[model samples]
Target: MKLARAIHFDESDMRVYASPARTGEWCISGGFEFSNWTEGDLTGKPRQAFANGWLGLETFGRATFVAVTALEPAELEALTDLLAEHFVTYYGAPSAEAARPVAQEEIGQMVELCEDHAPNTLLTVARELTESGVREAYRVIESSDAGLDQFAIHGSLDDEPHHH
Candidate 1:
């Protein structure tokens, strides 16, 4: 696929392509590429498919992320919200619970744990930034196929995680 944009975040490297799949849809796919996790490796990623399934992505992964239900242009926002909500329900610890009273050493270990786990990093990235990322992407898409190659890297969160 011709990569239109690439987002290199804390634990994930996502590339958004100007999809040749469908007009109003996006092609979301990627995975935990254990063997080759480098600067420009697409091996471990998922095959480019339309945004019409429970996209459980993993380049080197979210388990059943990016739902295809009720999909629309607004679905991007809805997907981000649903992902956050799912995290709140299943992710064990919500981002709101991040400010727990703990020893400095414990903080260090948790940080290390996240660093060691790609899924953990993905979750953290999801918690921190998915909504804004989707919004930005939609903005570009709405601008037209001409606005296809707008790549980006998100190294920080724009706001606190949402819960419900």
Candidate 2:
């Protein structure tokens, strides 16, 4: 399967990349940059500039990763809808009740694997959680004690001396 990532940096720029995880594996997907606009500036009703567009394209078979500086309540809802669309597109259909168990199981397996080997790479852990068919699994792991420990260990490793 072809994996794509759309990262929204702040409220100004949107970086869309395809297969950014691997080296020398570039794809035709390019990034989309957005201009910054205040609540009142967008539609004159206090709305996000990219909310509609982002939510509209969420139903396709694309994996989007949003990284915003600040997220509001309305924006959260929009993001949730986008995630739901992503799940439905990637999996089969939209059924949170049915997807929850599978998502949880995938997250559990990711936790176990990270604890066993790559305990010093939280980003790797997060990526693994995402790739394991569990959308937003990082949020669950981030809220767990084990996940916090793993993050600390990963941080410590980053601060350690490099022998290579």
Candidate 3:
């Protein structure tokens, strides 16, 4: 099966996200985090996350990019359990048992989304609060169409107090 994993190209995510997802962790849309948010909440780091962030399953944190990858059944089940626990602990779900199905549904949506894309393809999400509610859109960049440079900056810079 196919799924997505968080990938970081730079330290920008650390600065922009209140909680940044660890690189190489599994990820999903995670839009549920913003369900209760209002226009007034859309400022600063939270705004950056709403603009573009993938919810990392392990850390329950935000990621800027996620690349398509393979998924094993065991891993899926574990992710579901983690999410269910999160719902109970954070979202006030009655119990883990009661939250299981909803967690499965959320992960299932991501699985369905990745099913059609090739492995290693990069995915990005953009969300906005509209008159009615939140609106989400996705952008896909196939591996063949993009390279590492597009996502990250390499090399180093030295500050020798050079004068120009």
Candidate 4:
């Protein structure tokens, strides 16, 4: 299977995000973090995160970019468990048992997004609060041999140091 991992090009993510995700952590849209937001809340590092950051499953932090990568079933299961616990601890979910399916669905949404893209393809998300609710759009940047070097955040997807 495939999913996305956070990639950092510089310290911008660290500086701008109140809690920036560590490079190489698994990420998801994490728009759930902003479900209660209002136009008034759109003002600072939180605003920057709501604008485009991907949420890291490990740190519950924000990331500006993510790269598609292979995933093992065991790793996916582990992530699912971690996310479920997060919902209980942070969002007041009744229990990890009750939250597991929702957590899986969130990760599943990301899985579907990456499923169509090739490994190492970069992805970014943009969101805005609309009249009805939050709106999100994704941009995909497919990797190319000529330009891949530009994204030094990722050395080679096949390289061990970048995986994790």
lDDT of 3 by residue, 88-155 (tens): 99999999999999999999999999999988888999999988788989899887666543332221
Tens-place lDDT digits, model 4, residues 1-164:
99999987668999999999998899999999888899999998999999999999999999998989888999999999999999999999999999999999999999999999888888999999998889999999876742554453445444443321
**Residue-level lDDT tens digits of model 1 in 49-90:** 222111231121222222111223354443344434434454
Better of 1 and 3 by lDDT: 3
| Best candidate, lDDT | 4
Model 2, range 1-164, lDDT digits (tens) per residue?
Answer: 11212332132323232212221111111111123333344342112222322222332311222211222446434434544444455666557555545443433343343343322222211211123232222321231423334223232334544443
Query: What are the root-mean-square deviations of the candidates from the true structure over C-alphas?
Result: 17.3, 15.9, 5.6, 4.4
Candidate 2, backbone clash total: 0
How far in Å is the alpha carbon of 24 misplaced in model 2? 20
C-alpha lDDT of residue 147 in model 2: 32
Give the TM-score of each candidate. Answer: 0.20, 0.27, 0.89, 0.90
- Lowest summed lDDT across 10 adjacent residues in model 2 is found at 24-33
Compare candidates 2 and 3 on lDDT and give the better one: 3
Q: lDDT of all predictions, in order shown? A: 0.26, 0.29, 0.87, 0.89
Error of 3 at 145 (Å): 1.7
Which candidate, 2 or 4, has the higher TM-score?
4
Query: In terms of TM-score, how similar is model 4 to the real structure?
Result: 0.90
Choose 2 or 3, whichever is better by TM-score. Answer: 3
* Candidate 4 local Cα displacement, residue 152, angstroms: 6.9
